[model samples]
Target: MTRGVRGATTVENNEAGEIIEHTRTLVLEMAEKNNIKPEDVSHAFISVTKDVDAAFPAKALREINGWKYVPVMCMQEIAVPGSLPKCIRIMMVVNTDKQQTEVEHTFQREAVKLRPDLLEDVQKDQQK
Candidate 1:
């Protein structure tokens, strides 16, 4: 049963370069820990808050990861009256044969503030 994991991060701005680099690192780490292969990724979606507009975070990931064939999409996050100001969220869809509980999701940096439990898990995994 293939499954997908979700993760998110808050960026300094909309510039695709930094957002992309950090996202690539996080995504790769999640994939590695969860035994997911890049080729198995059906798609990777990036959602930026309304204020971000440097480049598509997905494009940066594709370029950095050399995922030329992977489908990528970028969009604006829904505007809430007062939500996290500068956030970039990622939803990775992978063709994995693992149970949902086997998937690992990462929320790093300021994004960790959104989900402390998930961030703690990621930290524990990294220490291993």
Candidate 2:
């Protein structure tokens, strides 16, 4: 089965390098915990808010993971009223046998501030 997991993170600044590095670390950690190999990644999509326009977050992941064939994309998040700022979100689809309920999602830093519910779920998972 294939499962989709969502991750959200925040950038301290709009620097491409920093955003890329932060995203790279977050994605890699998610992949690591789920035992998802690079080859198992079907695709990765990154959405950044209007405040971020430095380098594409995907570039950082490609460089950090050294994935030459994995498809990646970066898009602008819809500007909704009262939306969070400096937020970068990632949704990754992985081919795995794990059930959706068993899968782990991550939200960190100020991003956690945006999704305390999701963060609580992750924390609860860690305890189990």
Q: Which one is best on TM-score?
A: 2
Error of 1 at 68 (Å): 1.2
lDDT of 1 by residue, 18-83 (tens): 877777777776777777777888888888888877777776666654577788899999999878
- The per-model lDDT (C-alpha) reads 0.77, 0.84
Candidate 1: list runs displaced more than 4 Å: 120-128
Question: Where in model 2 is the C-alpha error above 4 Å?
Answer: none
Q: Estimate each model's TM-score.
A: 0.83, 0.91
Cα RMSD for candidate 2? Answer: 1.4
Clashes of each: 0, 0
Q: What lDDT score is found at residue 109 in candidate 2?
A: 75
Q: What TM value does model 2 have? A: 0.91
lDDT of 2 by residue, 24-125 (tens): 888887887788787888998899999999888888777864576778889999999888899999888889999887787877778877768766876887
